[model samples]
Target: MFEACLDRGLTLKKVLDALKDLISEACSNVNSAGISLQSMNPSHVSLVQLNLRSDGFKIYRCDRNLAIGVNVASLYKIVRCAGNEDTVTLCVRDKADCLFLTFETESEYKVSDYVMKLMDLDVEQLCIPERDYSCVVRMPSKEFARICRHMTQIGDAVMITCVEGGVSFSASGKLGTGNIKLSQNSSVHEDEAVIVEINKPVQLIFALHYLNVFTRATPLSKTVWLSMSADIPLVVEYNIKDMGHIKYFLPPKIDEDSS
Candidate 1:
């Protein structure tokens, strides 16, 4: 048997919405430690990792390690049924064909229950290696999403240039060019602000459409971290407050003809 409780049902809803655009189905591992899922996009051009520790949940228990395959969109739909202030509980027994969800609103003295069918999937877990990135940019998640949305109108890809000044996002097309520069505001002492760190300045091009889709995660966190390096995938991370974080790694766009 396995069961987990979350204070805010909307937290799981938000996280699912962020991944719904990437993959339709995934296998979630539930154990004593917590629940986690890592899967690559259908195109295999990007990967997403989600982790929520047992301590992060209000109540978490698992009798045995179980791999539960689920239709993410369906699960997300079930979570959406929960009110913003409602508490959520998920329960599933060994060899169960469906997962049960319960949502309760204390103030209103209301309760809701949902049962979502499960799936059988041969999900492969990848081994992600560590890397020392050359550039790390921390900025408001919404700002990054806005820039990507605007750039997509002009071109299909964007070139990221990170230097001492800041990080510049630019895209060129037949009509014209669009560039948005986010410079670090060192003077601002606010903890929730933009920060740009560069060890070795680098310029790289990536698919703007993918980046735009990635912005779907902006709702999960106020601040997003972009860790980039040459010839390596770009890492986008969002911290879910008291819970753990979700990370995405997208391969860079490189010309095969070039050395």
Candidate 2:
């Protein structure tokens, strides 16, 4: 059993929301993910990693060189209950039970029983073999979210085409065509909008539902980064403070006519 506590209540809320979205979308295959936390030397930078191991899904973890696919929703809920204060601490009682305790000046909240079901989760981390990617894009999280939402209105899938100039998000269905283009200067937030750019032109199609789930982490991060290759899987990285980080991988669509 493991338990942890956090001091900030708002951070807990954001983390929970993001995890919920991941779990809901990653419902297919096994329904859980493994989470590990390691401390940085100065105790300032914290590394929280979530591993979803699935033979059908794939992702590249740069540090461990591992590829994994697994359900992440259950793990998200488990972490959400771990702490609720500004300063969070975690503990494991046995191999199966985890507890999360939050402390305020005069009050405390115990959320131990919530993580019980996640104990039996069977998750594996694969060694990710190296593969050169053709394109990478950096954009505002909110802007990406807007593009996803807009494309979703047109069809069940969104076609993403990356070019040297920029990346284009488009969806076509019976309703016609819906497109959102982000260039090197696209801004999602006035004060913090990061520049968007791509290295080469690579086009891939992704499911709208998955995009929606992956972008849920946008509210937690200032910007979102995407790495892609032609007909290869798409990687979405979400950076969260104090809590941890999440990466989502979606297999590229081969049949555009069917999508």
Candidate 3:
């Protein structure tokens, strides 16, 4: 059995919305450490990992490790019922087949409860080892989102070029080509400003749609980190306050005559 409480329900809401686009069902692992989820998209093009530490929660309890498979869409709908200041509690009994959710809003003088049926899922656990990417870019999440949104309108793929100058995002489509560059800033220092770090010049191409999908985290984090290498997938991570993080990995989209 386990019970976890989150102060602001919006954080959980954002996670669900971002996940709903790629996965319908998910197995959430609850343990003494915290809550975690690892899953791949149906097409196997992208993988997502989520972790929320126990201390991040106002109240957390777990007697034993538990894996509960749930319909994320239903869970998101239930979370939507919560008010802005509402506290959301997720709980389950020993080997219970249903997950109980309670929402409390004192100011609104409203309390809502929901019970969602769970399923037993057979999931394969993957050992995702740490990677050394060729280029790691840190920038404002909003700026990255805007670039992806605008460039996606011009092409089906986004080419990210990392060189001595900086990092650039370019796309070519029937509408013509679009490009956005963030040059290396050697002096500026800010938590939310654009920063680029590259060991050697490397270029990667990925589906524009996937990049746009990854941008769903813009609302949850001020800064976004992009790690890329030719031999490995691109890693996009968003650090949420008082929470762990949401990570995404998208395999590079390949084409003939593409470098």
Candidate 4:
């Protein structure tokens, strides 16, 4: 059995919301300092790592590296019912079941047993190999969100062209093209609008949905970190805390003519 507690209630709520946006309907893995959800939405796009340390919570103690792959939708429902802004305590009881308890007054609400259709999800522990990245961009979370909202109007995919100067988020389709530029100096604090320059341009195309999922953690962070290279997977990272961070990678699209 594994259990943990937090001093602030909203931190749990934020983490749950961030996970809910990415966690798949199929399976999930929770381990020391991290939780990962793979192949929950589509085949080509999957998230492998999410660090909870930035939220000021770490593994108090783990008898073993517990891997619980459950239906994220089921977990989401249970969390929703537990109410918002309440101190949350989560425990995994064996490999078969998990528990969510909320404390208020002298009472604790057990919400997990209320979930009738408990999915028996098989857990697959994966080792994600690291790769060297050429370009990195750091910018405010709110500005990134604004760029996403604007780019959605143009197309299904956004083309991120990275260079030494900075990164540009652009989308073009039948409607037209929309672009937002972010520079390294852009403040992750208080500033809503941002623009930046780069040294050499490395252009890549990514599904807007994946970008949306990765950037969802931006609001919880002061800034977002992006690492990319020409015709390679892009890594988006947010340092939530000194010990924890969230890293999201999206595979680049291959062009037939260029190849």
lDDT of 3 by residue, 158-239 (tens): 8999887578999999999999999876566565567778787788899988889889878888889999999688999999
Instruction: Summarize candidate 2's per-residue lDDT along 174-215 as a digit string, tens digits.
Output: 999988876666544442454545556788888888788677
Worst 10 residues of 4 by lDDT: 109-118
Per-residue lDDT of model 4, residues 175-231, tens digit only: 988887766554434344333434456788888877877766775677776777775
10 residues in a row with least lDDT, candidate 3:
184-193
Clashes found in each candidate (C-alpha, N, C closer than 3 A): 0, 30, 0, 10
Shift of residue 132 alpha carbon in model 1, Å: 1.0
Candidate 4 Cα errors over 4 Å, as ranges? 26-40, 53-55, 82-84, 94-96, 105-119, 186-200, 255-259
After superposition on all C-alphas, the RMSD of every candidate to the true structure, in Å, is 1.6, 9.9, 1.5, 4.0
Report how far off residue 101 is in candidate 1 (Å).
0.4
lDDT of each: 0.88, 0.55, 0.87, 0.62
Candidate No. with top lDDT: 1
In candidate 1, what residue range of length 10 has the lowest lDDT sum? 185-194
- What is the lDDT, from 0 to 100, of the residue 215 in candidate 4? 69
Candidate 2, residue 157: the lDDT equals 89
Say which prediction, candidate 2 or candidate 3, comes out ahead on lDDT.
3
lDDT of 1 by residue, 1-259 (tens): 9999998888988899999999888999888988899988888889999998899999999999988899888888889989877999999977667899999996858999898888988998988888789999998898889988998888998889899869999988897999999888767644457788889998888998778878888988988999999989999998988889999888889854476
